[model samples]
Target: MKDVLMNERHMLSRRKMLGGAGAISAAVAAASVSKVAMAALPEPVIQTKPDTMPPLVPNTGRPYNPVVTLNGWTLPWRMNNGVKEFHLVAEPVVREMSPGFKAHLWGYNGQSPGPTIEVVEGDRVRLFVTNKLGELTSIHWHGQRLPNGMDGVTGLNQPGIPPGKTYVYEFVARRPGTFMYHPHADEMVQMAMGMMGFWITHPKGKHPLIDEVDRDFCFLLNAYDIDPGAATPKIMTMLDFNLWSWNSRIFPGIDPLVVRHMDKVRIRVGNLTMTNHPIHLHGHEFLITGTDGGPTPKSTRQYEVTADIAVGQMRQMDFLADEEGDWAFHCHKSHHTMNAMGHDVPTMIGVDHRGVAKQITKLIPDYMVMGERGMKDMTEMEMPLPDNTAAMMAGTGPFGAVGMGGMFSVVKVRKDQKRGDYSDPGWYQHPPGTVAYEFTGALPDPARFKADVSPGPGSMPSMAKPAQDVEVKVRKPAGGHSGH
Candidate 1:
C-alpha cells in the first residue's frame, strides 16, 4: 500500500514538473522521507568565528564568543571564492515550545525562526534555498538593501520558489546591522506558522559600540493562536492571539539571558507580530543603539527602561549588567504574558456556581465550576485538556508557581558567574534589610524620606506637581492589637 501511494505521488509530481517548473507537494515529499532519515542528516556546521576578518575586540571585560541563543544556534556557512555560501531548506518542523507542548510549524533548515545568519560587512553572500513545503514560497530579506531581482517577492521581484525547487539569492552584506527574513508568499499564513530567522552583519573593522558588547543575542518575536490542546497555530488570527513567543518559544522553556556582572550586553529584538511590543527590562536602563535601518547615531542615543519594537521592525538594545540579580525581561502588555487563554469563557468571578455545578455534576461526574473568586485557581488546576494542548498558564519557579506564560524570560546576572557559562544562576538572593518589610506599629516620620525632591541637572521635568504637606494616617486593624 505504501509503495502504491509513493508511486502515485511520483507520477503526480512528474506531471506537475512537465506542466511548468519542477513542483511537488510538501506533504508528498515529507511522506517520502521518514523521520529517521531527517534525523540522520548531519547537523549544519555553525561557524562562530569569522575567517576573513580580525577577531572582534573584547568588550565585556571577558572573552566573547558567539552570542549563545538560549534554545537556538547559528547557521554555518562555507567560503566559495571569497563569497560566503549558505544552504537553507524550507520544510515542516515540530518545535517544542516548552516541556509538554509542541507546535507544528514551517521553517528553514529544520528549526523555526530559522538559524541565525552571521556575516561580516562587505562580504558577498550566496544563499541557496530549497523549498520542501507543499506550497510555493519566497523569502523577503527584510530591511536588507539588496538588488531588486533578489528581493524574494513572489510576482513582484521574481517568481516564487515552487515546491521541490531551489533558488539562489546573492547579495553583498553592505550594511552592518540586524535584519530578518521570512516568506513573502502567503506571508500572513507562513509567517504566522513560524517562518522567520535573524540576519546579522558585523562591521568589517573596529566598531566601538557594536563590537564592545560582551554578549550579543538575537531572536524573533512571533505570536500564535493555538488553543490549549491544539498542535497547530490558527493562521487566520489577526489581532487576538494566545501564544506569544520569542523565537517560537515561551517563558520558562525559553532560555534565560545569562551574563556576568558588569558585562556589556546587546539584545537584538525583532518584532514580526501584528502588534508592537514594548519590551521592558527590569533592574537596568539601556540605550537603543541600532535599528533595522542601521546603527543609531550617538547623538540620538538615550537611556530607556523600556523600548517599543513595532511590527516588522527590529531594534538592538545595549546595557551593562552592573546589577547582580535575576531581572525580568518581557512584553509590557499583560495579556501578551499569558498563553492559550480562552477568549470565549465568561467571567466567573463573584459568582456562586456551586448549586448549578452540583446539578451538572449529577449528569457529568467530572464537571467542576471554576473562576469563582478569580482565575488564580485555574493556574493550579490540572484539567483534562486536548491531546496536545499547551498548558495556558504553566511553569513553577523556586518561590512558587510563576503564574505567567508566553513572552517572558529572566536575565540572570551574577558577580560570581563564570565567563561563557550559560547555565541558569537561579533566583536572585536579596540581602537582609534590602527586602521591603511592613512597619506594623506606627507610621514612619515623613521627614526621613524627604531628601532629594529637586530634579537633577539633565533630568526631565516632573509631569505632575508635587503634593504639599500631605497628612499620614495609619488605620488600626478591626481586631485591635492582634499580634505585631
Candidate 2:
C-alpha cells in the first residue's frame, strides 16, 4: 500500500509540472501566431473582495449562523465559473488568547484555527495552499471523502507542499457534515502550533430534519502547553498541556453563542486535542445529530445534556433555545475548563506559614507566601512573572473576579432579542417573587419531658430550664455505685 501510494504521488507531481509547461507552450504558440489579436484581448477581471454568501441551514432556508469569532472570520472564496476558489497562506501568526496574553503560532490566512470553510454539498472546490513557513507542509482535509491524489498527505497521497510553493487541490464536496483541515506533515508539531480550521459542508437541497436551523456555529478544540510567560507553545509537551481553548481562544475572551429564544440551533464542534471533551450545556439539552462521517439517522439521534467529542473527532449538536438566560456551555472536566495551573504545588490548606514567611520577607522584602491557605488570593496578586507571561488563570464576571479560565463560555438566549441581532442581552433578571431571602419571623418549640437525674463523679449538674419545663426527680441506687 505504501509503495503504491508513493508511485501515485510521484506521477501526480509530474503531471502537475507537465500540465503547467504545456499550458505555457500553448500560450506562447498562440501569441506568436497572432500578436495583434493577443494585444486586443481584454484584461482579466480582478476581484478585490470575496463573493461568499451567508451559509444556510441544512434543510431549511433559515440562516443559522455563528457570531463572529472574537479574532477570526470565515474565509472568503471567489466563484470561478461554477467552481469555488479559495486561497490559503500558511505562515506564523501572533494570536491573542485574550487581553494581555499572546502566543506565536502557525496558522493559515492569518489566524489560528484558520477560518471556517463553508460550502454547499456537491460544490466543486479549488483550494490553493501557499506555504510561507521555512519548512514544507501539507494540508489534509480531515474527514472529507475526496480523490486519493488530493488527500493532502505528505509523501503518501502527494508530495509536501514545499516552502514558497503553492499546491492546488480540487474536489467535489461529497457529504454534508462537520470536518477539519490541518497539516499531515510534521502533524504533531504543526498541530501543536495551532495549524487547523473548520470545514463545513451544508446539505444539498432540503432535508426534513436538518434543512432549517435558527443558529449555526463552528469551533475547533485545541490545547497548548505554553508557560504563563512564554510566547510560543512547547510542542513537545503533550500530556502536561495547560492552555485549553475553543478556536485558540479561552473563555471570557471567546465570543458567546448568542441566539433568539425558541430558535433551533446547531453547534458544530471539532476536537483536535489528544484528550476527549465532555461538553456540557447548562440549562438545556441537545441531541447529537451529526458526526464527521455524515448526518446521523433520525432513529439514532440521542438527546444529551453533555456530548463527548473525542480526539480528532467532530460532533454536531442541535437544540431548541427555549430557555432564556446566560447559560454556561463548557467542558465538564474540572481542570480542562481552567487556564494555566501549577501542577507541582503541594497541599497547603492547613499549613501555617506566617512565621516562616515573616522571616523570609526580612531577607527578600518582596517575597510573599502563596498557596498556604488557598489559591483564590493568587487571582488578585500581581506577582512578578517572566516577560511575555500571559495571565492564564484569569477572568472577570459580573459579581467579581472569576478565577476559572480556558475552555468555557456562555450561550445567551434572550426572549426579547431583536431579530438578526447577535449582541449579548446582559445578565438574567429574576421575577419579583423569585429571589431567595432570609426568613426572620418564625418560631417552633420542642415537646417537654421529665426523667430521673443521676450524676456520676466528675459530672456537672443538669442546667435549670425555663418555667414551661416539667419537674425532674433525683434517685439513689440501693448499693453505692463507683464511677471511674
Winning candidate number (lDDT): 1
Candidate 1 ranges beyond 4 A from true positions:
1-65, 208-211, 436-484
Q: Over the stretch 399-470, how does candidate 2's per-residue lDDT look in tens digits?
A: 666776789888889888876666667877766876567789767787655566564587677698577976
What TM value does model 2 have?
A: 0.77
lDDT by residue (tens digit), candidate 1, 107-174: 87667878777777788887767777899899999999889988989999988887876667888988
Model 2's lDDT to the true fold? 0.72
Cα-based lDDT at residue 126, candidate 2: 74
What's the CA error at residue 261 for candidate 1, in Å?
0.6
